[model samples]
Every structure is written in structure tokens, then in C-alpha cells.
Target: MKNASPRWFTSSYSENGGVCVEVATNLAASHGTVPVRDSKTPTGPSLAVSAEAWTTFVAMTRH
Candidate 1:
């Protein structure tokens, strides 16, 4: 991904005006990484975690 802004996606389970979380799917494909940031600020800094790390974090959050 170059010469462009990152695309962020919120969880499908999120309700209207709720749980402001956004993730960049593009990062996953190019670098095998997951970039996450606040949906409220699209241009803000994000945290990148490895694919395996991301999955493990999600599993922990789910439980």
C-alpha cells in the first residue's frame, strides 16, 4: 500500500455510534500485519501487531 491512506474497518457487531474501533485490512495483506486505531480519528496513529499476535489478542478479547 503506497501513495494512499489506510482503509479502516470496524467490527460488524458494532452498533450505530458505538464502540469506536477501526482496523486497517490493507496492512494485513501487504505485511501480514494488523493495524488498529480509533475510528473517530482516521489520520491518527495506529498499533500494528503480527498476524498470529492479532489472532491471539482477538481470542482473548472474545472470552
Candidate 2:
């Protein structure tokens, strides 16, 4: 895959103060990974999780 930039975005439901994480799902198709970082620190280190794992995690949280 090419070097794709991560387009970070926070959830609309995360309105409870400034404690939230940002996710870059835009690279899931091209990179097969989802980069996640803290909303408080945009320049901080991010965690790269597998696309499949991220999907499962989100599905579990919805239950």
C-alpha cells in the first residue's frame, strides 16, 4: 500500500468534556489498519490497530 495520510476525526457522540480519542478509518481500505490517537494531543503517538480488529471492537461496544 502507498503512504496514505491519516484523516483523524472524533466521534460526534463524544461531547462529554474533552476526553475522547480520534480515529483515522480512512486508511482502512488502503492500509488495512486504523490509526487511533488521543483527541487532546494530535501530535502524540498513535496506535495502529488492524482493520478487522477495529471493526470487531466497535461492534462489541455497540452491544
lDDT of 2 by residue, 1-63 (tens): 588899999998899688999999999999999999999999999999999999999999999
TM-score of 2: 0.92
Candidate 1 deviant stretches above 4 angstroms: 1-5
Q: How many clashes in each structure? A: 0, 0
Model number with the top TM-score: 2
Please, what are the lDDT tens digits per residue for candidate 1 over residues 15-59? Answer: 778658887767666778888888877777888878778888889
Total clashes for model 1: 0
Kindly give the stretch of ten consecutive residues in candidate 2 with the minimal lDDT sum. Answer: 1-10
TM-score for all models, in order of appearance: 0.70, 0.92
C-alpha-based local distance difference test score of model 2: 0.95
